[model samples]
Target chain A: MRTHRFAGYLFILPALLFFLAFLVYPLLHTVYLSLTEWAGFDLKKITFVGFDNFKLIPPDWIFWKAMRNTFYFVVGTTVFLNLFGLGLALFLNNSTRFTHVVRTLVFIPVLLSPVIVGVMWSRIFDPFGVLNQILEKLGLIQTPIFWLGAKNMALVSIIGATVWQWVGYDMVLYLTGLQQIPEELYEAAMIDGANRWQMFRRVTVPLLKGVATMVILLNFIGGVRIFDLVYVMTKGGPNHNTEVLATHLYEVAFWFNKMGYASVISVIILAISLVFAYLRSRLMSEEKA
Target chain B: MRKTWILLALLLLCATLMLPAAPKTTLRLWSWNNEGDYPAVFEQIIARFETANPNAEVEIQWVPYTEYNEKLKATIAAGDYPEIPEIHPIHPGSPMYSLYQAGELLSLNDALKTGFPKYFPSALADLTFEGNTYSIPLDVNNLTVFYNKNIFKKVGQKIPETVDDLISLGKALKAGGYMGIAHGAKDGWPAGDLYFQMLAYSDGSHTMLRKADFGKLTWNRPEFIEAALQILKMNANGVFPPGTAAVDYFTGAVQLFTQQKTAMFYPAGSWIVGGFDTGFPEGVEYGLFPFPRISKVQDSASTGGVATNWGVLKKAKNQDLVLAFYRIAADMKSAQILIDHSMIPPYAVNIQAKREILADMIKAQAIAQTRFVFTPELHSQVMSGVQGLFTGEVSAAQFVAALDRVEKTIKR
Candidate 1:
């Protein structure tokens, strides 16, 4: 038994070393930086100002604006992404040639680079772009609308593009969950006079909870720390209408040269993610019990 | 005697081996895509410099323009910056100022005095802080009105010379179903120049912004408010295109201008002529002029000055080699090279005009030199205020007030 345990430790040593070097050290360093005021260029210039950077966050209107935008995206991306994912999975859950083709087509956007998706969507949202031209040709609108110009519509446009890109990822997970559900449960419910809707409500929802939880948590984390699509698409512009936490952190760190404040924002992001993950694990354990 | 000669040869060889080797200095240079063919031109200059100084060598790193600033800041934070890096004159909050404050930039006073002429006085003044010069002036770029001659001919109107004429012309072009100005406010930096131009044209002073930086004046003054109003007026008069807020510089404004979809464009530099030549749309006869003056302002001026300056690291080991390179870069020969490559050099040099528009552009810059210095930071507050003006989130009064608020936050 002692020999076996020693061999297991030996086998895991390389991976453990990499994890400590890349993840653990950097995380601890970032936390240390959050307490000090540094310009991010020279080490000698760093001043230890405990909690001063975090104190600046509450009064900073830009931080609140970014927080609000992040919250909206998190809520918007989670609810809409899950609904669309489940809907698409239900529609194309069968083993047919048509379903296979549709699934491949749906996954194509996920295969595209995020930056490319941002640029493509930005062009598509242009006033003279293809979408507007089609809309105009169909006589649905007399004039082209500014998809990314308006304040209310910019976030909506970003959400639409994000959903289009990530919904397929969710669909694949839900589809697997659906396949694992035993057909006997459906037949048993049918014999007990339960209709399709009742059977789905009673059986499908409960059985798919694990997959649903995974999808929501993954997407929720992605939405909370979102940066790339907003960056390549809007760059927190049109008067910062689309500023999120990650973009704001970038601006603070690089543009403003305030590394300490950026670390504070990073800590906030990490804490939010940790709390969500912890709650998820607790919920899963309770469900098992 | 033959044995004696052999022993002498061996002694000489031993002496040669005893002498220390000459240390070959390696200087790392970081630059971004400032213009077309310019990077190649820079590489050639480096090769020539290397040939002249056989004991030294240079390594150039090319970074994309979009990510250059971020990457540079991170690299510097990690204490791994190259010996020299390209610095911008109008970086928001002034990255040059931050680097200088952190003692990361080398003072180039001795270098300029030794070799380069006093060609970029305004730029030098801008980069100086507390009696220390931080960077070497490299090139000058002016913001000008690039108008489509065919668009003007279609409307049967000459290019506007004053703000009122611009507005009237814009209205006429709108009536004719064309955008008056192809300005993109999506990036927020381009539109701020309009406000500065207005202030400089009206006030006849380019120091208002610098004054604000020193807390000598607030932004809600009547003149500044008038400048903010001028932008709002332009927006209200249908001068800018629909969805102007969504269009960025590369993908939207430049595309529309080149496609002849808009009549006028405010390209940030004269090098845009190169862009026009490469992607020549048929029947597109473009012209350049300084931004027009407001009709009511008696003293009118145009905003013009250096766009970017190169700086050396303070603790860089290759100071002599870097200073030698600066001397070469600032010489008239390098200026000629710049003019040949379709870039406006910081120093004046005799060059045959390749095109009539290039000559016109050079003449326009000379005229603008006397008018006003480039005061980009003066309008940084207004840059942020553009979306509010477009979205009706802030009134003109509120906009000016917001600028005042922003002024208070500037770290000088």
Candidate 2:
């Protein structure tokens, strides 16, 4: 037993080493950085300021705006991505050739580069772009609606594109979860005269809790770290309405040359993600009980 | 005896082959020239340089203009910058000066004095901050408007010489089923450039811009407020293209202007004039005009000078070879290449502008009373304020207040 324990430790050593080196070290360093002030680029320029960087964020209007926008993105992306993914998984859960083909088609968007996705969606949202052209042809609107150009519609448009990109990812996770349920349970539900909706609510949902927890946490974390699409699409613009935590941190670090302030923002993001993940895991554990 | 003779011959051949073939040096040059045939032009120039100097090789890393500065900053931050990285000219208020203050750049004054004697002093002064020159300019640039004369004629309008004239002309063009101006205000720089040009006509000049950069002048100053108000008025009066906030400078404005979808294109003259040869439609006559002078502002000036420049890294290895590359970069051949690309060469060389509009641009640059500030941060602040004004997110007063707040924060 002692030899087996040693072997198990040896087996985990590489991953533990990697985690410490890449993840833990960076996290600790970032925390250290949050306590100091440094213009990014040259470690020697760092000045220890001790929580002043954190203090500055609460009063910054842009930071508040970014937080509000980030909250919208996180909530919107998490709910919509999960809903659409589950819907897709349910509709295409069959093992038929047609369903497989449809699944492949749906997942094609996930394979596309994010930069390309951002640019493509930007063009689609253009005043003279295909979306406007189609909407006009359908008699939905008379004038061109600048989808990405208007502050009201820009975040919604980004949310829609993000859902479109990530739904397939969640759908695949859900499909696997669905397949894991026993056929006998559904048979017994039918024997008891529980209809499709009843069975889904009682059996399918409870059974899928673990997968749902994983997907929600993943989506929430992704929403917190969202940057590339925002970078490419509007650059958090049409008057900085689309600014999220990641893009704001980027602007502070690179554009504003406030690396220390950016580090503080990063810590906030980490803390938010951790609290979210912990709450979710606890809920999952309670569901299991 | 035969074996010994063979061995001696082989040794001689080995010694001859290993005699250090001119100490070939490879220098990495970073540039923000990731657009149509500009990279090709640089490649051609590098080829010429390599041919002239057999021992030197230059590898070009073409970063897109949008991400160039951020990437450069990251590289600097990580202490992994290239030897001959591109630096914007040394306006004291610019990010380049900030980099200099951080000791990131090597002083290039000696190299410039030794290798590029003909480089204009006024231009050199633009890149010098507090007794140290940070970069050697790649080219000089001036901001102006290029208008499609045919479209103007169709609308029965002459080139606008004043702000009111521009607005009126824009109205006329819109009525004629064309865009008034192909402006990519979405990119921020276009709008910033417009404000800077307008600022030059006001009490604000390069000095005022520099003052704003150093937190000496507030954005709520009368001159700045006047400039901001004028810009807001221009946007309100429809002086830009439809969906102006959605348009990008390169793919939108340049493309639309080249395709004759817009009547006017305002951007950097030196950079935009090159499109006339390559992308512009055949027989589409265009004319150049200086940025229209505002009616209320007394001072008159234009925005131009050595804009894009390059500096050696403080940790740059092979300083002599890098200087050699600078010599090649600033030589007459390189100047000729720049002239070919519609850029004003730093050295004194007579360029016969092929287009009449380009000729006007060159003449205007030569005779301008003052130049715009090369400070990126000032321009960025102005851009955000102007954008806020355009979007009705902030009133002119609020915009100025926000700018003042930024000045305070950055100063801290």
Candidate 3:
């Protein structure tokens, strides 16, 4: 029996070692780095400054701007994605030939890499691009709108591109949740004189709480860590108007070589993500209860 | 009889194994020059180096320009940098400066004592730190105005000789319903370059800027403010493209110029000469001219420095092979190869321009002045401030003051 347990441990050791090496070790190293001042090129040159990097965060206006932009993106993407995803899922709950085709079309953007998505959308948002051309043809405005160029519109444009890409993912998840609900629940609701809207509210929503929680958590985490799309699109430019936490971290770490300060920012991002994940677990447990 | 034959075969195998193996060395080189005719040029140089040293083999890794610095830094941090790593910018502001300061780069001083071709003094100064030469510049380039001849003819404007004339030309181009000048402010560096060009013209020298770079002087000087105001004035007059803040280097500025949407491309480097020869559309004729003088009392100097420099890693296993490679790369024959590919070599060579634009670029490089090397922090701050200026989010006073604030934080 002891030998059997030892054999099982031996079988799992490789994976456990990989997890510790790639994940846990890096996390601990990053925390240690956050407490030091280093140029990021030399490990021997690291100077322990004892939370000085954290102290710089509050006073740096760019950091505050990035935080605000990140918050806006997280809230914007999460709320809108859930709404559109649930709406589409409800409209195409019963799978058919047309619904299947539509579903594929909607999910197509999700299949594309974020870099491709960013490049495609940047062209679309160009001043003389298809979007402006259509708006001009329809006499929507006198001048072409600089979608990615304008300060107010840049973040909104990124959020829109992200939603267009990932809304289908949320839709597919909700579709699965919808299928998991028993047909008898809907039948009972209809037999009790409940209308379509009433049935949706009482039967569908209450039953999909678990999937909804998962979707929201995923979207929130994705939104918080958003990097590639923004990096490729705006590069946190036009006066750092669209700067987010991830892009700012990249700038400080790679461009500025302030790895310690960048590690501090990374720690904050990890903390935010962890708190949201904890809340998600609590909510999931409550739904089960 | 079979046992005797087996013993004889074993004796022959042992004799073959006793012979010494041939000595072979492989030298790895890393660079961001993968595009254009760079691959062909590098191939020729490597071919020559390998031929000169029969026992040596050369391996090259070409990284994309955007990701090269960060990737190189990561490799260095992991202690896996190649023997010959290309140090782009090759100035104090570059990430290689930190490596040099950390004693990670091999000093090329002793190597420079013999067999190396004469390089431009300014280019050599750029690669030298604290009296020690750290890298050798493969090419040097300076910025000049690239004008679309078709647009110039259509607008009936002549090449500007002074700031007033340039502004007038801009107005004429705008009035003709064309973009006056294409400035890629979105990328940050181009915008900062424009500002620095103006600052150089404003002060008649890069002295003030250099002083500020060394923390000996504040950035909020009269000349700095004047340069900022000039950018704003040009913007206010509709001299730039619509939504100038949104335009980037490649898709915006180069595209606009090649497509005949812009009358001129301002403050572009000599490195783009090769790109233009291939990328320009048929019948789209372009010409180069020096940046117009901003002050009548001072001569307008081109803002440029060396590019595509090479530094040897101190931990490089094959130092002699690395030195041999550098010797081949820094010679007149290598200069000729670079010239054939439309790259301006830092070494003195008999340059005969095949194209009119190349001739103009050569003329511009003759009068080019190297700018001060800014720290990375100051560089970023200046670039961000320039973006703000282009977007009209900050005035000249505000821009300089912000730079001063950032400058105060540097430890010097």
* TM-scores for the candidates: 0.91, 0.92, 0.93
Tens digits of per-residue lDDT for model 1 on B1-412?
9999999999999999998978878888888865665675687678878888988888888887667777876787776767768876533356445676676777676767777866756667666766667777766766778888888999888977787888899889877878888877777767666666777764555567656645578777777777777777777877778777787776688888888778988744665666776655776788877777777445435666765567888766778788888778777777777666666776666776677676766666664532222222334346657776775566779877776665555445
Expressed as tens digits, the lDDT of each residue in A152-204 for candidate 2 is: 77799899999989889999999999999998999999999999999999999
Q: How would the candidate models be sorted by TM-score, starting from the highest?
A: 3, 2, 1
Error of 1 at A129 (Å): 2.2
Worst 10-residue lDDT window for candidate 3 chain B reads B88-97
Candidate 2 lDDT over residue span B1-412, tens digit each:
9999999999999999989777678888898765544676678778987888788888998787667667887787776767778877655545555577688788876777686847777687777777888888877778888888888888899877788988888888888888777777777777777777777777644477667766777778888777778877887888875566766677767877888878888775766666655777787788787778887354445787775677888877877877777777777777777766666776677757665665676677764533444444455666766666656566778767877776665643
Please state the Cα-based DockQ of model 1 relative to the true two-chain complex: 0.54
DockQ winner between candidates 1 and 3: 1
Best by lDDT: 3
**TM-score comparison, 2 vs 3, better candidate:** 3
Off by over 4 Å in 1: A1-10, B1-26, B34-37, B54-58, B77-79, B89-93, B296-300, B367-381, B407-412
Candidate 3 CAPRI classification by DockQ? medium
Worst 10 residues of 2 chain B by lDDT: B367-376
Q: Which runs of model 2 end up more than 4 angstroms from their true locations?
A: A1-4, A183-196, B1-23, B65-81, B90-93, B96-98, B204-206, B296-300, B367-378
Cα misplacement distance, residue A49 of candidate 1 (Å)? 1.2
How does model 3 score on DockQ?
Answer: 0.50
How far residue B139's Cα lies from its native spot in candidate 2, in Å, is 0.3
